[model samples]
Structure formats: structure tokens, C-alpha cells
Target: MIYRKDRKVLKRVDFGAAKNSLMGVLAALVVYALVIAWGRVYEAFQLETLLVGGAVVVVTAFRLWLVARFDALYGAGPARWRKLFAFGLILHALVWGLLPAWLVWRVGTGFNFFVVILYNVGVTTALGSSWMAGLKVRQFYILLMFLPVIGALFLGGGLREWLLALLVAAYTFYLFRLYRGQYELFWHAVTRERRSGGAERRRELPASTDIQLSLVYRLAHELRTPMNSVMGMMSLLEDTRLDDEQKEYLQVAGQSGKLMITLIDDVLDYSRILTGRITLSPDYFDLRGAMEQILEAFGPMAQAKGLELAAVVDRLLPKRVRGDRDRLMQVLTNLLSNAIKFSERGEVRMDVDFTAEGEHDGVLRVRVSDQGAGMDTDTLKHLFEDQFLDGAVDAFAVRHTGFGLLVCKGLIEAMGGAIGAESVEGEGSTFWFTVRLGMQADMSESSKLSGAMADIQGVVVGAGAGSLACLQEEFEALGSQCQGARDYDHALQALRAGHREQAEFDLLLVDTHGRRELALNLCRNVLEDPSLRPVKLMLMCTIEERGEPTVQRLVDKHGLVTLVRPVHRTGLRIALGRLLGVPRSQPVQDLPTETPEERRRRKLYRLLLVEDNEVNQLVTRGMLSKLGYQVKTVNNAETALALLDQENFDLVLMDCMMPDLDGFAATRDLREREQREQRPRTPVIAITANTAEGAQARCLAAGMDDFLAKPVHLQELETVLRRWLSREDDSAAEEPDSE
Candidate 1:
């Protein structure tokens, strides 16, 4: 029994340290061959040489034993394995250093075949042992095992050996490159494991526990701040003494708050999905209605960014389908979001098509296409893989967590659908997915209509704030009733009382200023309450202070609408019109309908271009000018500041990522000067491609209004200017000094 128990334990240890043991043995054999070679050449096997050789064997054995012991004791943590491997490496060096080559050569009879074979076997075994212990060891071990064989063939005497040597050398070079690539991959995995923690017995328990707790804490805190902001803005909105402009500004604050709450919910849901805790609740619902709702949600974002967004549904499809409405909407929203994010100058097209089944049934196909920076086959293959963003070492490239596509895939697959992508590098990409659902025979007849009529009520919040007054005016002028909020408290009180008081607002909007927290809280309270479940909420804010996770949560949770700060009147009006079911009096061409040339033209704007380097200035000027923008050039912030004081440019294109009077300091000075002299605040848009960490927040905090990363695409510049310029005129004109 005792022997059996010991054997069992040894088996377990052997299973764990098998790879390392093999590597040690192989290393010992290589040293043995060298020793024999030295012995034969020198014909001397002294006591000192024997002691060194014995020490080499002893050290190798000891190191292998230590590794096995450590793994048995500590559960073979990666760190412990590394330490043991280092010791083995030391033993290898010692063995090679102390071996008596002359004695080996003499005893083994110059180039003894037996010694060579034994040494090769030993070295191969040692290397193979180490390789086998790894996660994906088989392939690597085979490669390593073949290396020595090739080396021996190359080193062997004779014409055949010489020919084999040439082949071996070529193979060796290839293997060397392969090893370098694998090492990079190994290092990447190690770093990721260190950062995200290991996946093993206790993997999810501790690391996930911490992540969950941290998320909960962060959500609670972050949600509260935005809630407070919304509440405060609503409170101020109730103050009748405030002027229309002030009221408009307060309304903007309220809108921003609502957006914050929406973002919070999105992040929470996403986190839940990440933790494998998201439960899909499927129910029969109107598929068209769901698509319309999603479009309405993202309409504001697309408009705010000056991007054209449109959804086309084939009339032959059934209006209603049985599925998880929320998950389906999420998939659509994610696809649309990606389309909008990547596209610069062109329109994002979303089309729904119906594929007929054998007789009457059919599948619903949704396709989203964008003329943005599309991916190559290589990128597309890894698009949905986890930790893909870490591989994007370039700063200027668009960053993605790879979570969106993965979630989309999961949701679609769960709903019995297939999703895929088709793309051409640099041209465009189209992501399409199909959902199988039982079609309603009777309902299919109604689908002959051009577009489904949507009954949407537009409720404009924060109409009292100066920045949003024009937006409010635009919405009202379009025949939608605009509700104004001055602060968060007033908005919450109004939201809470509106239902009871027989006064109902279909949409809530808040600005993100002092009322950011209030707006977010109001959204949470409203969304969580069953009584207030019907009302849709929207938020408008600068992403300057918030992290991606925060924004993602809000978007995932509450079906909240987000309009980035400094939205134009047209964009705001169109979004509100679309959401509230108000007909757009002006038939503006949708983005998807616009040609590339038209897009370029529409995207052009007046830019206050600032650059210190003459060559850079010239390069930028030529680029912007070619893109059809009116460029106002300045060599430094001083000149840019003077130009701002003297002229009303569409946007102040500042070089914040510059040297000397760097962008941040210059922005601070500009804001300070504007406030001190009572000058209208110009929107200083930072033109930088620098991912030099923390530059974005610093720019925003320093009072620079907006940012556009460097190697600036004309489309990006156009979008920023169109949004910021419109808001600039409203905010800038509202300043007391301006009057």
C-alpha cells in the first residue's frame, strides 16, 4: 500500500514535471557527448574533470527535482515554473562548461557513433520534456526535437552530410524565425495573464469576484454623479426667473444627464454578459417596431456627429417575430454603432431583407455597411477574438475591445442566427446577420408599404440652456413640444410628478455640466421604475472625463440615446423629429444616399488651422485645402488667439499636441483670457494624432472644447466642425459680453 501510494504521488508529479525532466535529460546527454569528444581528443580523464562532470549531472538532477517539488507544493504556478527553468539553464551552462571533450573523444573512439546517438537522445529528451509541459506543447516539442537531428546531420563528415547541412541550415533559419514569432506570442500571453490574472482552479472565484465588486462600486458611484447633475439641472429648469437662454442651457444639462444614465446601463449589461450571467428573455414582439426603436436610439448620435444614418426594411417581411427583443435590438445597435464609428466621409447603410423559405416561411436578414476604414481578411478573421485590441500597438488606429462583435455573435447565435462580414481593405466592409423566425402569413401583406409608420413623441429637455436653445427652437418649430429643465432636481421632480399630474413627456434630454450626475440618476430612477417605463431618455455630453466602460454601460442598459456635446441644430432637429414621430418638413437627403463627392463637400468646414512647423503647416494646408475646407492658417497659439479675437471662425483648430506653448497650456490661457475679458468661448478643437497617454483628458480639462486625432481624416474634421461650429455660435453668442 505504501509503495502504491508513493507511486501514485510520483505519477502525479511526473505528469506535472514530465516536460522539464525530459529537457534536463536531453541537456545532460548533450553535455555527455561533449565530454566524450573532449576525452577522446585530449586522452586525459583527470579526477578534477570527473568531479566537474559529476557535478554537472548532479546539478541537472537537482534542478529537475526542485522543479517537480515546487510544482507539487505550489500547484505549478507560472512564476514557479520560470524560476525552476532558470535554474535548469544554469545547470546546462555548468555541464557544458565543465565537460572533458578530450577524454570523451579518446574513450569513445573519435566521433563514436554510440556516444553521438546517446547524446542526441538525451538532449532531445530534455528539450522535449520542457516543451511537453507547456499548454500547446506537442507542435513546439516536435519542432525542437527535430532541431538537433538536423544539426547533427549538418555537422556529420561526408558529401551526404554536407548536402544535409545545407538543408538543415535553411530549416534552422526558418525555425529560428518561427521561434521568434512563438516567443512573441508567449510573451503576449504571459503579460495578458499577469494583467487579467490566470485561468485555472481559482480563476473565476478571486479575479472575477474582484472585478464584480469593483464594477458594482464603480457603477454606484458613477451613476450617482450623473444622476445628481440631471436633478440639479431639472431644478434650475423650474426656476421661472431664468431667461430663455439660461433655461436652454439647463435643458442641455438635463439631456446630458439622461444620456449618462443610458450609458451606465449599457456598461452594466455588458459586464453581466462578460461574467456569463446575462439571461436572455425571449418574447414575441414586433420586429419592425424593435428596429424603429433602435434607429431612434442611435439617431441622435449619428446626427450629432454629422453622419447620415438610415434604416431600410423590405416590405415583404412580417412585422412581428418571436425572439428576444432586447438581444436582437442589441445586435442591430452594435452593428450600426460600428458602422457609424468607422465611417468618416460616407454614409452607413442598414438594410433589412427577407429570404423566402420553402413555401411561405422566411428568414430576416439585416445588413449594415459602411464606407469607412475597412479591414483586411487577416483583421476580419481575428475581429471577434478576445484581447484583440491589445494587438493594436498603433495609437492612431481605432480601438476596439472586441467585446461588441463577440456579444453580437453570441446574441445572434442564441437567437438562432448567423453573422458574418465581407470587406475590402481601405474601401469598406459590410456585416450581415440572419435571424430565423416563424413569419406571420397574415402580417406579410401589410409589409408592402414603403416604410413602417412609427408613432414617436418628441420630448426635448434642457430647452432653457443657451447652448441648446437653437436645438429646442428647431424641435418646436418642427411641431414637437419641447420640455425645458434647468437642473437635475427639477427634472426628477418633473419626471416623478408628470405621470401623476397628467403631464407626460415621451423623451427626456439633459446637458452634461453641473447637472450631469442628476441627469444620470434621473435616468436610473425612471428606467428602474415600472410606472415610468414607457418614456425614452436621451443624454448629451462631452466624453472628456468619462471612460469607455462608463459610456458602454449606459448605452447597454437603458436604451439611452447619446448626443456628443456641441450638436448642430439640424442634427438635433432631425433626431428629435425621427424619435418623436414628427415628420421632417425639410426632406434632407440621407447620408447613405449621398455620393462620395457630395459627402466630401458636405463634410467641409472653415478650420482655424494652427501649426508651428513650416513643413507640417504646408502639408496640412495642402491636405485640408484638397479636401475642400476653408483653412485659416496660424503659426502659433498667439496668432490663433489674435485671430479668434478678431474673427468668427467656424472652429478654432488648435495644435494642442504641439511644442513650446503646448496645446493644453494654450487652451488654458485661451479659456482664462476669454473668461477674464468676457469674450465668447470659441470651440478650440485639438488637432493631434498623439496617443501619448492622457493627452485627451488633459486637452479637455484644460478647457479645449474638442479633439480630433492627428493624420486627421477630412471626414473626421468635417464631422467635428459641423457639430462644434453649430453649438459654438449658440453658446458664443449667449455670453453676456457678446450682447
Candidate 2:
């Protein structure tokens, strides 16, 4: 057991040492690499030289990865990463000590052997002095690195070796005296920063971008650690037996946690844009899914106020388009958030359409309309400007918070998109934005519907006109003839008429616009009507509506499929197919849907999954294994380093943020190692929740070949994997071994 006081002191030591050890540690690795390459210098003892040299390289690289991320892995309560970091430092010294002694014992006191002794002295004093603080740890490291060399020299016999050993011994003693002073000064500085708050001091520094970048990564690590734990525990619990109510509670907790994590990532992205680094990351994504996601996020808030929240995509628009999904979602989120915040009743709806620009390119437009207190003309003029002028809040009739509007404006303009809004006083507002997107080759609006729901009939009862039209289009898109109704009476009449022809209607979709009582009556009528028995009864309700006792009873006893508000077409299609007792045979059209034969044909290449969380591990490995890839998952950067050194991997799927280290630095160091050893470059793809373009650039700069955003979908994963794995390696031809 460890005492808290002693642990605190050790944390300080580890933190300080980590701050100043990276460059020195990297220099030590360079020395090791150089020594390994010089193995041919001892031609007679080449194999022995290579053996010890390889050990040096491995130990140095291990130190490099650990020291690079020691602070991140160090938490307040657990000393797990702390102890591991200490062990790495000690091992680094021990390896340096024993390996060189073995080299001299094997090579004898030849000319090059003396040269080896001199090299060891220079490296020991040089690198050891560079280590910042931590008196005991550094002193121990110094002794271990020097003693073996001194002992080996004394064992060399003769007056010449003795004289040189004495001189080295005198220098090591002198070096310790000097190192103590250095440690004292560095420790004081660490204490000072710790007392004042390191971040406060960092912010006061001159380099603005560096300060922001460090803060972003540090905050991300701090938040991600606990979120990972919560989600991991949820995943573990999912495998256990539980009652129906308990399972539902667990499911809700898991989904809420996922949304929270996404919100945290948005915080990071928001900070990045504030740094004035923005770009567009265009890729293939489902537009309908993106819109549905934003609407779902704000649906509950709207429903709480007895308002309707819905999104509609034009039937003429492609299901899949090539654009920057993150920015598009960000823009939509800002608009929808404002819409729901200001709206008290009525409806908030999002609409989408396309404007063709060329054969392969087009402008995608989105509009968010809300029945909120409309902005005045004066407020609309300065809507995106800072509302607080001279510390005075005068901008009244605005839509969203000024900061959010500014961020959205910057991101949209960076993507070559335009944003504007129109409003009428005392009425409502509609904000619209447009961005250029690439059309998939031979893109078409219609998907060939399969026999699962082909030629079927459905009735849609919606509280809002926008929702009514949207649901009908979605039904028709799935090859079902749909009849729309504005109210419950019309829905019942349509059902009665359609069901007269031997249950003509295959499904019924009802949207409960906060009218729990009305929805409950409709469910009872559906159960009582014998003709509607074979028809799939589905209700789209808000969170509050789902809690109504009658609605719960109708769903539990009568086998009604209750869908949460803001349901997407894809999810609805699958649910209907399952209820109808048929496989989901819907066409994806130009969407990247992998067939069974093609999925199986993918080579079972070895994949290294470097994620700090077990839930993420559960998610990623489960997906990759199904795709036939042999996966090896590691939780920390050091273990990942060790594995990469020992085994060959075709590709690496790494969470750019790790528990103890920023994956960017780790990947950067890994790239440097590959170059030093002249090894083949394996594609390293970053798995991140922040899909902002600046973050993508940072990943690439850190030596990652590509990126996959979090909550990764199967189709997207397949596309990313196939693109990288199928490419010819341009760097596979190593340079001839010239040390």
C-alpha cells in the first residue's frame, strides 16, 4: 500500500521529469540506433554486436513512448500508469548499463573497444544531465548508466584501462554534484507552476496556438478517461442477464453517455476553429442520417415545450453525398439548437434540397425553420457579430448565441459555403446555408426496393404538415403506397377503407406531437380493429409520450413497435422489414454497401487496435473481426510500441486520444522509428470523435495515413479500410542498409 503524501510527491517528480525528458530521451534513442547500425564496425563479433544493439534500440524506444505520455497516464487516484512510467525509466537506465558491459566483455580491449567506452561516457553524462528533475530517480539512472562502464574498464587489465577508468570515475562523481543543483532548480520551477496552476501559467505564455493546442489535448484526455470507463462498464453489463426494466435503464444510460461524449468532442472542435485553422474534409456520408441525428438531439427539448420537431429530405436528393459531414452537422446543430431554444410551441423543421453545379459537383442546401420569436431587422444585421460590445449586451432579437453563430459562419465560409437567414417580427425565423458537395458517379434519386416491402401500403398520421409530407415520402421511397392524414379521424377512416381489401395496409406510422392521451386512444383503436391485426403499428413519440402508462401498456401487451422521435428512413425501413418477417433487402443505390461475397473476400490482414477504452475495444474489434481481420488490441501506448516492434501489422486503427498519451505524438515517434529502421510504412488510421478538418490535418501531420471518426458505421469502416489496404505501398522499397 502507498501513502497519499508519498504518492503526491512522486506525482510531482513524474510530472516534472516527463516535462523535460522527451528530447533527451529521443537523443538517447538516436544514440542507440547509431550504435546498432555501427555493429558492422566489429566485423569479427558482428552477431554479438547486433544482439546487444537490438536490445538497446528496443529499450530506448520503450522509454521514448512512455516518457512522451507519462503525465496523461498519471491520474490522481490510481498509480497504475505512474508505476509503469517509473519502471520504464528504471529499465531504460538498466538496459543502458548492462548492454554496453556485455559489448565490451565480448569485443575485448581493442581500438574500437576503447572507442565504445568513450562513446558510453559521452552519452551517459550527456543524456542523463538533460533529464529535468526527480533527484532519487535521476541519481539512480546516472549510477546504473555509469557503473557498468567503469567496472568493464577496470576488468580490462593493464595500466592504460585503469587510468581511463579512474578519470571516468572522477567525472561521474563531478557530474552528480552538478546534477543535484539542476534537479533543485527544476523542482522549484515545477512547484511554482503547480501552485499557480500550470494551465494558468501556460496561458500567460507567448505562443498562443501552442497553448490552445496543449489545453485542448489535455482537456480531451481528462474527459475521455472517465467517459471511457462509464461506457466500458455499460458494455460489460450488456453481456449479463437483467430484467426488462433494468435492461431498458441500461440502454438509456448507454445512449445518453454516447451523446455526451459527442458533445465533449464538439467542444474540442469548437476550440480548434477559434484558433483560426479551418478546412473542409469531404467524404461520402448519408445526408438523411446526418439530419436525423441533429433532429433527434433537439427533439426532446422541443417536445418538452409541446412543440413538433422534424426533418425532411427532398425525394430528388441522393441518399448519399460527398461532403464534410462534421461541418454540415455542426452547422445544423447550431441552427437547430437555436431553433429549439427560442421556440415555445408549434414546430421546428429542417428541409434539404440540391442545386446541380456540374456533371460531378453540386451545391447542397439546408434550411432550418422555427416558429420562435422572430429576430428584428436590426438584430439580424449583426446576428453573427459579437453581441457583447464594450461589455454591453445590446443585441436582443438574435437567434443563437453570438459565439455559436460566429463559429458556424467561420466553418461554413471555410468550406466555401454561404449562410443567411430571414425572419418576420413576432412570427418565426428560417436560417439557410449552402455548401458545394461532390456527387457520386452516376448518382440517382431512386433506389430499387426489394420484395421485403415492395408494393405494400401504409398510412401516416402526423401532427405537423412538414412531418406528414416527410413520412409519406419516406414510405414511398421504400416502394410502399402511402396515404397521409392530418388528424386521428382521417387516419382511422383511411385505415378502415384500406383494410377492407383484406388488410391492404401493411404498416401504420403515427407521430404523437406531445398528445399522449390522443396517441393512447389511437393505439387502443388499432388493437380493437381486427383488420389492423396483421398491420405493423408503429408510434413515433417523444420521451415524455413514451412514459405514458397507456402507451407503455399498448406497446408491451399488443406488440406495437414504438420508435423515438426523429426516426431516420434507414432505421424505419429495417424495423419494418423485421416486423414483416423478411430480411432488409433495401437497395443502397450509390451507397457503399458491401456484399457478403465481397466482405468475405477481404484479406484477413493483421490489424493493431490501439484504444484506451474497453468499450471502444469491444466496438472496434467486434466490427473488424466480422470483416475477417485478425485484430490485436492494446490499451496503452507503451504496449502498442512493444507490439509494433515485435510483430508486423498491415494496418493500425488507433484512437488518436489515449489514456496516457496524445496518439499524435506516439504516431509521430512511430513514424520516426520506421524511418530510422527503414521498415515498411503500415497505414495508420486515426479513430476520432472530432471530425473537424483542422484535427484531420493534425493527424496527417503526425504521420497517420487516414482517419475514421467515432461512432464509426460499418459501411464507412469498410470503405476506409478498403481504400487504404488496397493501395500499393510507395515506401515499401527500403533504402539499402547504409548506417
Candidate 3:
């Protein structure tokens, strides 16, 4: 009963503190008015000294009450107390110095100098000593000092006034030192408290390692699925007789691979709260234009999930706000993705509003609301906490990772704004965030959109002749300049020439249907060349089994952007818009790059091949030989390694999978071994089909430079030999070796 009573008393005290904060401000204002009126009354009765002293007392008391009220509201700590004392000193100086000076000048009283100086000293001393006394003692001291000062200035003689002024000045200096010393001690305590709290949080985090591991494991599994798809697509591309339809299917496979890579990157980013690393590289971008680009990316996924995704951007949202365009897209993507995932059948709506919320500061509020399964109060409460749902095992909800909210929170906070979620369980949830951005002054709508579009630079390489023509037509329609490059060498030359002439082309569209290897080679060449590095390369590939790996490598290795086979003019335009930093006006229509017969009419190449691996060598030799290539077999890199030393062959198909020397090391030995012995360099083709990522590049880097993926196709082998052998014949032909 006694403990309950004490708890009640403590609660009452808290309530009193709140009530006093509000009431005190009102009381102070009233007192200020009363003091002003009383001063006028005293002046009317010809009591000049009394009126001035009374006014000073009343004003000082009011200032003290206001400080107290602020403390009550905010809570009194060392920091608050120090601020209160500082404020007291400033108020005292204003009331004592300026008000008294003005009154003396107005009344023409030369004697008011002593009154002003005495009041200043007394107020300063009171402020300095305020923190030292107990509540009772402090209040008593205030009353005593103020009452006597009021009385003395009003009625005391000149000698007594001089003594009082001397005393006040000495006390004021002493009190100043006291207050300064106490403030230093208070700050030290605060620093220690913060350090202690941080240590405790660190301790708590390590204890939750099990929870952390679970989340990391799940995320890794999710990422691997896409990676595997990319790998599988790469393996399928070795088929020799893939028709146009088959190629189209592969192109879609490659697009899926690209999407998976992006998804993995985003998921990892959401997992790690490195929000500060997401810097805003802001360029001019239109509000609706940016949304359209994001919408296109999400459209297919939303459609597949049977979700209706819609956007409603208010015209008031400044058509262009200075911000990181990619980051904004990321923010929108995260929001839309989450909305779609959570919503079962209802719609996901994105509404953007621009409003001026502060002095010279404009705010863009993007509210992404969904008519989905709303979260409960508890879930919403813990939404942004990093570890709040770290241990959740529910696969459905876990997919969202709650990390998205954390990222959203960090981004909004970094942008000088706030993000919050409101939900009513089983009803719906609305997630909204605001960004306070400085409005761009003097930018017209068209200029803003044009400025945004102008930043993207596109480079299309190796587009099939037909696709190249189609893309050119589309470019002409869009008033964009199009340049064509037939092969890797042509693309590199064009890129170099453009760089040399300082010609600016907004987009580079490359066709990769029949020329996937050539296109990839060109992309690698451009990326490797320092001179052509400025051009943003986009690969246009037909649907083929190998499209996934090829696209993945293009994107991962060369940072190449891709548009799958059957190019849509609208998608191409938007991609150009995004890459070029243009505001998108409309979605590009999908246009088939190559007709069925056009793709079939492309030439196929065959070659005499040699490989060592019983499984790989037999499979590859059989596959290529079956596809119309005349293949030769060697048991090990040593035999082919020896045979290459003696013979001139159409193409010395070297196997990296061999004993005595591995394919890479053997190739190096074959290429450099000849260089060391002063023999002419033979074009050694690598035939080991290793599915490992970066395996082919590693083989080329080693020396027997040309690569044909394992289970080699007759056409790929033919293409590989055609490229190197043709180059050789143009210079000097060598005789074939009898193995």
C-alpha cells in the first residue's frame, strides 16, 4: 500500500511538471503587462527612480519564470540549467542596460547611470549563483536580492546606493566563476553517461548473433537462385542450331539474369544499413519522368503477381527537384516493391506532393500507400528498428526483411526529412516519407526535362544489321543520332574516332543476336580502352540459351546495360532517356530486331578441334564434331602441347583441362614457350568448358588467348577460329600438324 502511494505521488509530480510548463508562460506574460502598467503609474506620480527599479524587478522576474517554464517542459538537466542561467544573463542585460538607458535619456536624468550599473551587477550575480542553491534557498535569495534592489534604487540616498553598487559588482564576478565551473563539471558527467549507454548497446548487439546469422543465411539463399539462373543460361548458349525463336527465349533468360543480379544487390543493400554510402548524385530530372522509368522496371513483376501498380503525382510537385536521381529511384523501387509484396489484390498508389514548409525551403513528400495486408501496431512500432524483426522466420514477411524500412528511414533522415508508416490491421498501410530539397530557381519545365535527358550517354554495339537499321529508324524518329559498328574492331574505331573528334552521341545501341561473342568482345574492348571509356554501352542480344551468362558478364564485367532481343522502340527510348538523363516522355514500343529468315540466313563456322578431358574433351569434341566441325583429339595438354610445337593447323584447339599443365597454365606455356624459343605465335583456342564465372577471362589473361566455352558448338568454334585464323591468313598461313 505504501509503495503504491509513493508511485502515485511520483506520477502526480510528473503531471504537475507538465501543467506548470504551460501555465507558467501565461503567468509570465501577464506579469510583464502588469509591470509595464505599474511603471506608468509610478511615473505619473513623479516617482522616477521607483518606477525604473520596479520595472527592472518585474521584467527580471518574468524572464526567470519563462526559463523555468522551458525547463519544466523539456526536463531539467545540467544542460537545461546552464541554458537557463545563460538566458537569465542575456535578459538582465537587455532590461538593465537598454531599457534603463532609454528611460534615463527620455527623462533627462543624469543620475540613472548608477541605477543601470547597479541593476546589471545584481542580475548577473543572481544568474551566476542560480545553480548552487537548494530550491528553498534559491527562491529566498532571489526574493531578497530583488526586493532590496527595488527598495534601495527607489528610496535610498546617494552614499548607500554607491555601497550597494560596489557590493553587487564584486558578487557578480564571483558568481560568474561559480557558474562556469559548475557547467564544466555538468558537461563531463553528460559525456560519461553517453559512453556508458553506447557500451550497453554494443553488449546487447553481440548477444543476438544467432538472429543475425539467420537473416544472413536466408538472404544468401535468395541471392544464389538468381546467380544459378545466370550460370545455367550461360551453359545453354553453346547450342549450334539455335533458331530465331530459340535465340529470343535465351534473350529473355539473359534479362532474367540481369534482373536477378539487380535484385541481389538491392537485397544485400537492404540487409546492410550502410545508408550513408548512398550519396545523392543529383541531376535535373522530371518528377513524372523519373517515376515512369521506375514504373517500367516494376511493371512486369507487378503484372506477374496480379497486382495493380499506379502512380498519382500532383502537378504541384516541382517538376524537377535537385536530388540524386538513382537514389530517388531506389527509394521508390523499395517502396513499390514492398507495397506490391504486401498487397494481396488491392492497388499500390504512389502520390507525390510539393509544398513550401519552411522559410526558403521546399519539401517533396512522396507517399506510397497500399491497400494491402496492414501490419499490427506492434509490427509498425518496430518497423525501422534494425534488429526489431531480425529473428522473424516467417518466409512470406521475412522476404521484405524489415531492412527496407530501415533504409527508407536512413535515406529520408539524410535528406533532411522524415519517414513514417501508419497501418490499421487488415485494413491497409500507408508508408510516407518527405524530402526537404532546395527548389531549382529559374528552371523552365522543358529545360528541366531536357537537362535531365541530356546527361545519359548510350553506346549500342554489334546490333545485327537488321536490328541496327531498326534502331536507327527509331533514333531518327526520336530526333537522336545513331551510329553503327559491325564488329568489335569497327565499334572500337568508331568510339575512338568519336572521342578524338569530341563528338557527343547520346545513345550507343548494339545488336548481339548472331554476334553475341563479337558484341561481348567489343564491349570488353571498349571498357578496356581508356580512350572509349566515356561511352555508356548497351548490349542488344537475341533470345538464345547463352544470353543469360553473356548478359551477366557484360553487365558485371563491363558495366554494360542490356535490352533483350526484339527491341521495343519505347523501352529503347526510355533506356536512352534514363542512360542519357532525359525525362522520359513515352514508353518505347517493342520491335523485333531480326526476322526469322534473317537470323537463319546467318553463316555458321566449323573447325578442327583438340581437347583433353575425357568427359569435357569427349563431350565437346562430339558436340562440335556432330555439329559439322572436323575435330581432332589429344589425351593431354602435353600431346596437343607437343603437337602445337610442330604443326600449322586451321586452329590448334588447345584444352585447358589437361595433365602435366592445366588448360590456363598450358596455354600460357604454349604461347610464351614459343615466344621464349623465338617461334612464331600460334593461335591456340581454349576448349575447356568450365562453367565457373570469370573462367574464360582467366584463360585469355593467361596467354593461349582465344576461348570457346566447354561443350563447344561447331558454330562457336568456327566463329573463334574464323576470327583468329582469318587474322593469321591475312598475315601468314601455317601448315596443319599430323597429331
Q: Which one is best on lDDT?
A: 2
Tens digits of per-residue lDDT for model 3, 38-129: 43534443465465556656655755565456546445454454355445434444444444434433542223434334344444343432
How does residue 483 of candidate 2 score in lDDT? 72
- TM-score for model 1? 0.32
lDDT per prediction? Answer: 0.56, 0.69, 0.53
Candidate that beats the other on TM-score, 1 or 2, i.e. the better one: 2
- Report the number of backbone clashes for model 1: 110
Q: lDDT: which is higher, 2 or 3? A: 2
**Residue 503 C-alpha lDDT in model 3:** 77
Over 550-627, each residue of candidate 1 has an lDDT whose tens digit, in order, gives 555777876566665444433554555454455655668756623564335434446788877453465456555555
Candidate 2 — which residues are off by over 4 angstroms? 1-276, 296-301, 387-402, 424-426, 445-462, 475-509, 526-539, 542-564, 571-583, 586-739
Better model by TM-score: candidate 2 vs candidate 3: 2
Specify the poorest-scoring 10-residue window by lDDT in model 1. Answer: 446-455
Clash pairs, model 2 backbone: 73-660
Q: Estimate candidate 1's alpha-carbon lDDT, on a 0 to 1 scale.
A: 0.56
Better of 1 and 2 by lDDT: 2
Ranking by TM-score: 2, 3, 1
lDDT of 2 by residue, 461-572 (tens): 7647667767777776666677777687777777787677655677787777635567668878988888677777888777776788877788788877777776556656
